[model samples]
Target: MGGSGDLDAQLRAAMFAHLARVSAAHPDGVPSDVINSFRFADAPMRLIVQPGIRKPAQLDAALTIRTTWTPPGAAAPYADEVGPDGSLRYKWRGTDPNHPDNRALREAMRRQAPLAYFYPVARGVYQAIYPVYLVDEDQSAHEFGVDLGQYPNDEDDSAETPLDRRYTRRLTLQRLHQVLFRPKVLRAYESRCALCRLRHAPLLDAAHILPDHHPHGEPVVPNGLAMCKIHHAAYDADIIGIRPDRVVEVRQDILTEIDGPMLRHGLQEMHGAKMFLPRSGRDHPDPERLEERYVQFRAA
Candidate 1:
C-alpha cells in the first residue's frame, strides 16, 4: 500500500509538470488531467510512469499511447482496426526517427511516468484503448503497430488460414468492445441488473441488446444493459424479452413450465416487471433498437 501510494504521488507530479508546460503555451489553461491536443504532433498522449523503483533497470520510461480519434462530426477511419497481436493502430505522422521533435518527445516520455487518462471521444462518451509506446521516428508502418509481444490467442484455430484470422479478428474486436462497453453500461445502470435487479458485480455482464455483428448494433451505452450472467444468457438465447416500453416478458413456454427455484425466482417471476433504466433519458435503451431485438425474442 505504501509503495503504491508513493508511486501514485510520483505519477501525479510528472503529470502536473506536463500540464504546466502545456498551459504556458496555450491561451486557455489546460486541465491537469487533460492533455492539450494541440501540444502533441498527433494527439495528446498520456504516459504511464512508474518512478518508485530504486533500480534503473526496473524503470519503464516510455509514454504509453492507447487511443486516437477523429475530430467531432468526422467518421472514425480507425474503427475496428487492431493488429492481429491486439495492438492499436494510432495514426501519428511524426514517427520519422530523424525528427528532433520525436527525439525530444521520446526523452520526455522516458523521464515522466505519465498516467493513463480517459480520452473523451464525443460528448458524454469516453473509452479506453489498447496500450502502446513510441519506438522511433522511423516513418515505418511498423511504428504505428508496436509489438506488445504475442498474447495467447484465445481462439484456438490449428490452421493459420484466412478463416482463422477472421475468427481471431472478430474475437479481438469483441474483447475490445467489452472493455469499453461494460463500464459504460454498468455506470448507466448504477451497477444493478436491468431485468433482475441483481447488484453483484461478479455475477453481472454488460449485455448487448443487439448482437455486435448486427448492422445497427454499436458499442454505445444505449445499446447495452447491465444484466446478471444468467439473465444475460437467457436474453441472448431469446428466452427473455425486453419490450420497447421497458417491460420484461419471459417466453410463454418458460413461464408456464414447472421448474425449480432457479427458473421461478430467477426468471419467471420477473415477467411483466418494468426494466430498470438509466436515470438520463438519452442514455435509456433506444426504443427502436429494443423493438428490433424484441422481434427475435417474440419469434423464439
Candidate 2:
C-alpha cells in the first residue's frame, strides 16, 4: 500500500511528537520500552533523541520518544513507528546488511544521512542550554532562573549571558568545597603555585597555613598558600618559606651535607627570589594569614 507526496513528513511529525511527550512526562528521560517501540532509525542506523538534564526533576509521566526506519530509494523513505494510541510497547529490526531485509531502510537513511546531532525545542530542556540554567537558578540574583538568552520564554524578564552564568556557578561551587581557607586563598593565588607559577587551576592547591591536625581555627586566605604538591610539603616542613618581602628561605637545618644539584641549584639559588604575585588587587594574599601559616612552617 502507498500514499503520495506527504507520507514522510507525516511520519516525522508523529515521531517528534512522541519524543516530546516522553520527555515532558518522565523528566528522567524516555524509557527503553518507549524508545524501542518506535522503531525509529534507518534499518542500518540507530537514531534516538533525549532531553538535556542537569538536576533531575520529578516527572509524573513517561517521556515521549520517536523512532523511524527509512526505506531505500532515490528519496529515502521514512516510516513512522509510533502511533498516538499511547501503547508504550513495540519492537523493530533494520534490514540485514546483506539480506536485503533492511536494504530499503538503509537506502532511505543514506539519502538523509546527515542529521543534526541535537535540535533545540524552546519549550524543552536542551543539553548545552540546561547547564547554564542550572547555574542561574542556583545563584540568588537570578532566583527565577532561565535559559542562556538564546530563546525567550513567556515568563522571562530579560536575557542571559553564558559566561556570566558559568563564572557565578564556578565561584559558588568553589565556595562550597571543603578547601576551608578563605576562598581568597584560591583567588589570591590566581590558581597558580606561588613558587613555580603552575597555572592550571585544578593542579594548584591552597595549602593550610597551619597543619590540618593542628587545633587551628577556621581558614583564612593569608594562612594559606597557593602551592603545587612538591612546594607545599617543602614549605610546610620548613624546607622552605617565603619572607614578607618576597625572599625565599631555606632552613639552616636543611643546609647540612646536601651535594645534589637539585638541592643546590633549586633551593639555595631560589633563596631571595620573589614569590609570584596575584594579578589583581583583591587577590593579594593576606599578610596576617601568611604570619599564621608561618608558625608551623618555622617550627620544622
Candidate 3:
C-alpha cells in the first residue's frame, strides 16, 4: 500500500512536470523518471503512462492498452472470465463495484486516465501526457495496444479553430517526428549519408523527400533519406537533387562554375550517380513523393 501510494504521488508530479513543459509550446526537454515532456498539441485524453513491471497496465493509444490482474492469493469476487477478444477478465477483489477503493480507481481511471501514452526515454523515465480512457475490460492476453480516439474526449473542444488545431497538431507531430522519425531513417540508411556515404551520425540528418508542409508528405521511413549536413542543406535548397529514378543531380550552373575539390567531389562528381538506398524495399524513399519534390528542384 505504501509503495503504491508513493508511486502514485510520483506519477502525479511527473504528469504536472510534463504538463508545464508542453503547455509552454516547447519541444520535449530533459526527461526524468517522474515525468516526460510533451508538446501542447498532443492528444490530451488518450495517453499512455507505464509504471514498470509491477504496474502491468500499458497504454498504447487512448484507451488502448495491455492491462493485467493477478489473482489475489485465493479469493476473488468471482471466477475468472474470458472476454470476447479472448482476453481474460478479472474482477476487482471487492464484492461491490461501488466500494470506495473501487470507485476511486474508476474515477482516477476516468480523470487521470492516460491523457497520453508515456514511453521510456531511458531506463526509468517515461513520457505520459496523452489523454486516454480505458473503455473496456479484457484480460486474456498480455499485449494490448488499442486506439482510444483521435481527440482527447471524442471532440475538439480544446482548439477554437480547425486551422488552429491543425497548426498545433502539426507542430506537435513535428516534435514527435524529431525523436521517432530521424532515428529510424538513420538506422535504415545504416547511419551513412545516401549521397556522400558519410558514416558519421553527428553530421547526418534524416532528410524528407517531400517537405513536411506538403499535404501528402509523411514522416515514415519510406519518406526519409539519410544525408550529410551539407548535402541535406543543398538538397533542401534545390542545389542538389534526387530524381524519382534514384539518380543524383546537381544544379547545372553550380556544376559548371565550381572548381574546388569540395565542388568536384562533393556535389558535381556525384551527378548521375545512383543514390544509396536502404536494404529493405519497404523502407526505400517513395518514388511518387520524390518525383513531386524533384519538380521543385528542377524549377530552382
- By TM-score, how accurate is candidate 3? 0.51
TM-score on alpha carbons, each prediction: 0.55, 0.39, 0.51
- Tens-digit per-residue lDDT, 1-300, candidate 1: 667546544554554565445534421112324442322223443342221011212133333333443564678643424655554443342446545333433443344333332333333233423232322222464233232223333354345786765655565556555556776677678778988787765567888888778987888888998899999999999999999999999999999999799999999998999999889787799899999999999988
Question: In model 1, which regions exceed 4 Å deviation?
Answer: 1-178
Candidate whose TM-score is highest = 1
Candidate 1, after superposition: displacement of residue 26 in Å?
36
After best superposition, candidate 3 residue 246: deviation in angstroms? 0.3
Question: What is the C-alpha lDDT profile of model 2 across 187-283, one tens digit per residue?
Answer: 5675677887776655556777565455653355545678877777788678887766655777876666478886776566666678887675455
Candidate 1 structure lDDT: 0.58
Name the top lDDT candidate.
1
Query: Residue 255, candidate 3: how far off, in angstroms?
Result: 0.6
Between candidates 1 and 3, the one scoring higher on lDDT is 1
Q: How well does candidate 3 score on lDDT at residue 229?
A: 92
Candidate 2 positional error at 238, Å: 1.5
Model 1: how far residue 187 lies from native, Å: 1.4
Question: Model 3 over residues 1-300: C-alpha lDDT tens digits?
Answer: 666555555554455556555523322222342232322234333223432211213221122121222332544224434334332233442455655433433444554444334333223323333443333332333222222333244455444476664454455445554555665687678779999899877678888888777787678888899999989999999999899999999999988884878888888888899999999788899999889889999999
Better of 1 and 2 by lDDT: 1
